[model samples]
Target: MDFDPRLTPARSDLAARRLQARVTAERFVDGTPARVVVGLAPLRRGPRGDARLDTEALAGESLTVYDEDEEGWGWVQLDRDGYVGYLPTHAYMKGDVARPTHRVTALRTFVYPALSIKEPPLDWLTLGARIAGIAERVVDGRAYVITASGGVVVADHLAPLDRVEADPVVVAERFLGTPYLWGGRSSLGIDCSGLVQTALEACGVAAPRDTDLQEAALGTPVDLDPAQWRRGDLLFWPGHVGLVRDATTFLHANAHVMAVSIEPIAAGLARIAAAGAPLRSVRRVERPQ
Candidate 1:
C-alpha cells in the first residue's frame, strides 16, 4: 500500500501505536501531545537545521509527538492539518493544550512584557496564531489581551476564533508584498499554497497544507475557462495554485516574483504556460454557511 509521508506518522523503526496493524515497525507507541509555545517553529523534513522546512507550527496549536529524539527534535504531527515533521523540542510545551480563545488577525504583532506599549517586545506572532486570553485591559485608550502565558499583545490585533472574514480573497489581499518563503505558513513570508491556505483558513475553512492536496480536496472542479472564474476560484497548474481576485486578475505568492503579488490572469497563465506548466484546473470554493 502507498502512503503519503506528509500525513503518515510512521517509520520503519518507529510508528504510531494506532497503526500497529496497518504498518510494520520495530516499535509502536501512541504519540504524546504537546502545544506550540514559540512564536513560530519550523517543521522540518529532517531533524537538522539544514533540512527542508515542511511547514510551520504556530503558537498555541497542539501537536502529537511520536518521538523526542536525542538531539532535541520532536517527530510530530500538527493537530491543525496532520502535517508530519520534526520540530525542535524547545518550541513546544510537553503536555495537553489549552483551548485558544482568540486568534491573531494582524499580519504580525508584538508580545509585550506588560500592558504598556512602551515595554520592549518579548516575542511576535503572525496571522493565524491563536492564544487564550486570561484577561482584558484598557490602557491609554487602547485594548490589550493578556495571554494565558502572561504575554501582553494588542487586543485589536486579535479576534475571537468564531469571527471570520467574509471572503478568503480579501484575506489573501492582505499578504501582498510579503516576501516569498518556501514552506512558510505565516504572513512574514509565504508560498503559493501557503497564501491560499492562510487566506481560506482565516475565513474559517480548514485546508490542506500543500498545493497537490489542496487542488484535490479544497473545492469541486469548475470550468477551466478564465471567463468563468470568480472571486475565490482556485486555479491550478502542475505544481502551483492561486486564487482568482476577479475575472481579470489573480493573486499568488510565487518564486518568480519572490513575493505575494497580483497580476492579470492571462499574463500569469501566459508566463507559466511559456515555462511549460499550463493551467490545469479551476476549482470554485463555496462560501461558509
Candidate 2:
C-alpha cells in the first residue's frame, strides 16, 4: 500500500480528539488489535521491523494502534512522544468499556510511578521495562490500568487501585508464581514489599515501602497465631512481608528463593524456622470504613 504523509496532520488531529473522547467518556476501544508506539519521533521511512521502543518512547504519554489490512495495521500514535508500529490482530479488543481487565496480555506499564518492572515476558516487547500508567477499575480483586501509551494493563505489572477497601488475598493472587527479584516491583519481577504494595494499591489500599514502613503504617498489630491469619493480612519476617490469602497460604515475592509464589503458611514458617531465621511479624493494613 502507498504511504500517505498528507494524512499525518489529520491523523494527529484525530488522535488528539480520540484521546479526549476516551477520557471524557471514560472509555476506550477494546478487544481489537491496535499498536500504540512508545517513542519520541515518528517513523521516517514508514513502518518496518526491528524498530525499538525506548524509555522516553511516546514520552510515556500516548501510543497508536493501526489496522493491518486497509488501515495498515492499527496505527498507534502517542501524544507527546511519537511511537508508531504494527501490532498483531490479537493484541487488543474492540469496544469502549471501562471495565477492569486482566493483564492476560503482557507489557511493561503499571499504575504507580515508583513501582518497578520485575520480569516481563521475553517474546513480548518492552519486557522488563519500568512504566507508569493509571489503573481504571478493580475486577475480581485486581486493578486494571490503561497503559501510558494506550491499551489495558492489568496484573502483569501493577498499581494500587483503590485505598477504600479490598481483598488483599485476592489481590495477591494476581502475582501467583512470579519470580522474585531484589528491589523489583512488577509482574516482570518483584520483591516482598513490591508485591504487597502493588497488590494493595491495585485494590485501592495504601501501604508503605519495605517491612518497616508497612509495619508502621498498619493499625495496632493483630495478635494471633499464623493459623488464624486470613486473606488481606500482612505477613512479615525480619526483612520480608507478604499478604496472607488463607490460613495455610500466603503470597509474597520472597528473597528466600526470589520470585512471587504461594505456599502453605506452615511450610513457609517452617522453612524459616529450619533455616534458623525468625518469623518476622503479621500486621494488617487497616481497612477503610
Candidate 3:
C-alpha cells in the first residue's frame, strides 16, 4: 500500500523493503497492535527522552506497532489521529480492550475506589478519554458514574458515548487558559490544532492533528472578510490555527501567551502577520441553529 513516509511510522522499513503493506497484513514486518496503558503517553520523534514530542496517545487508545529498537522504544502509529512516533514499549499493552461506554468531558477527573469523594483517587482521567461500565450511584445527594474498573467518577464530568455537544466553540471555550504544549492533547496542556481537534471531536466532528492537514481537509473555505466570519469558524496560518469565538474574537492555544487565550481578531491577525506567517485562509464549520 502507498503511504507518505513523513507521516508513516515505518518509513525506514518501507525503504528497506521494496513493497509496502498494511500493518495488519502478514507481509508487514514486526507489526503488532497494542493499546496505550498510561493516561497520556508522549509520542516522540525519536527513541530518546530528549526527542521532540510529536503527539500523544490517550489511555486505551490503539496503536499499531511497526518495530521496536534495542533501547525499548516502539515505532508506532496512533489509531485515533494516525500520528506516527516513538514511545516506550512498556507504555502499551497487547490487544484491544472493551470499548468505552462514556467519555470524560471535564478538563480532568478522578477515579475513586467508591462513590465517596473522600476516598483517595485510584486514577485520573483527562478530557476525551473513554471509560466503560457506567453505573450511577448517589453519594450525599450527588450522582457518580462507576466504572468497570471498580472506580467512581463524578457523573457531571461524563457524557454517554452516544451524546455529543452541539457547538464546538463552546467546548473549546471551556479550555480557555489551558497551558500551551506542543503535541499535547489533554487539558494539562494542549496546542493549537489539539485544541481544535479535541473541541470538534467532543461535538462529534472529526478533525486531524496538525494545522496544515486540518487546513487542507476540514470545513468549507470562506472568504477572509470579517463580516462573513461566524462562531466556530477556523482561521489558519502556516503552522497555527484558531477558532472564532464570535465575529470579533479569536480563541486559540497559542505559544505567544503560552496558554489558551481569546483576543480581538484584528489584533490576532496583526500579531500573526508580524511574525511572518500571514493568515492563510478561513474555514467555516457549520453548527446546528
Candidate 4:
C-alpha cells in the first residue's frame, strides 16, 4: 500500500496513533489538537527556515500536532485540507481547535484592537481566513465584528461561514492580478492550485491543497477539447491548474506571468505545449452556478 507523504502523518521515527494499524513506526501517539492563532503561518516542507513552503495555515484553522521538536517546529496535519507539514509551534494556540463563526469573504482586511479603523492595525487577514466572532459593533456607520479574543474586524469583509458564494468561477475572478506564490493560498499571493482551492472554498467546496490532490479529488473528468469546456470547468497540466472563465479563456495564477491573469485558451495551449506541459485534463464540477 502506498501512502502519499504529503498527507501521511507517518515518519520513520513516529506516526499518528490512528495510523498504527496502517503504518510501522518506532512510536505512535495520538496527536494534540491546535488552532492557528496568528494571522497566517507558513507551513514548510521541512523544519528549517530555508525549507520550501508547502502552504500557509490561516487564522483559526484547525490542525493536529503530531510531533514537536526542541527547535520549535511542529509537524502537523491541517484539518481543512489534510495537508501535512512543519510550522512554527508558537504560531498556533495549543488547545481545542477553534470553531469559526465567520469567514473572511473579502480578498483581504485589517484587524484592529478597537472598533475604530483609525486605530493602528493589529494584523491583516486574507480571504478564507476564519474567525470566532463573539459580538458586533457599529461605529461611524460602519459595522465591525469583535472576535472572541477581542480583535476587531470590519464586518463588511466577513460573512457567516454558512453564507457561501453562488459561483466558484465568479469567486476565482475576484483574484485577478494577485501576485504569484508557490505555496500561498491567500489573496496577497497565490499559486495555481491555491487559487482554485480558495475559490472553491468560497462556494462551500472542500478542495485539497495541491494540484495533484485537487485533480484527483475534485469533479468528474471530461473531454479536454476547448469547445467542450464550460465556465466552471477545471483545466489541469502537469503541475498547474486553472479555471475556465468562458469557452475561449481561462484564469490562473501562473509563474509565467508572475501574476493571476486571464489568457486565451488557444494561446495558452500553444505556450504550454511549447513548454512541454500540455493540458492533461478538464474536469466539470456540477454545482450552483
Q: Compare the candidates by TM-score and give the number of the best one.
A: 1
* Decreasing TM-score order of the candidates: 1, 4, 3, 2
lDDT of 1 by residue, 76-154 (tens): 9998988999999999997755778999999999899998999999999999999989899998899999998889989
TM-score of 2: 0.47
Q: Write the per-residue lDDT of candidate 2 for residues 89-199, one digit (tens) a residue.
A: 233434432332232223343333222234342223222222344446565666555454454454544323222225656656666677775545455556787667656
TM-score for each predicted model, relative to the true structure: 0.98, 0.47, 0.89, 0.97
TM for candidate 1 is 0.98
lDDT of each: 0.91, 0.49, 0.83, 0.91
- Local distance difference test, candidate 4: 0.91
> Which ranges in model 4 have alpha carbons more than 4 Å from their true place?
none
Q: List the RMSD of every prediction in angstroms.
A: 0.9, 16.1, 3.1, 1.2
Model 3 agreement with the true structure over 1-289: per-residue lDDT tens digits: 6666436655533321223435323344546778776667889988898999888888667777877889989888787888888888888877655557888898888888887889998778788887775579887899998776677889999989789889888888888899999998988899999999999988887788999989998989999888998888999999999999887898999999999999999999998999999999999876433
- Evaluation by TM-score, superior candidate among 1 and 3: 1
Candidate 4, residues 163-198: lDDT per residue as tens digits? Answer: 999788888888899999999988888999999998
lDDT of candidate 4 at residue 46, scale 0 to 100: 95
Whose TM-score is higher: candidate 1's or candidate 2's? 1
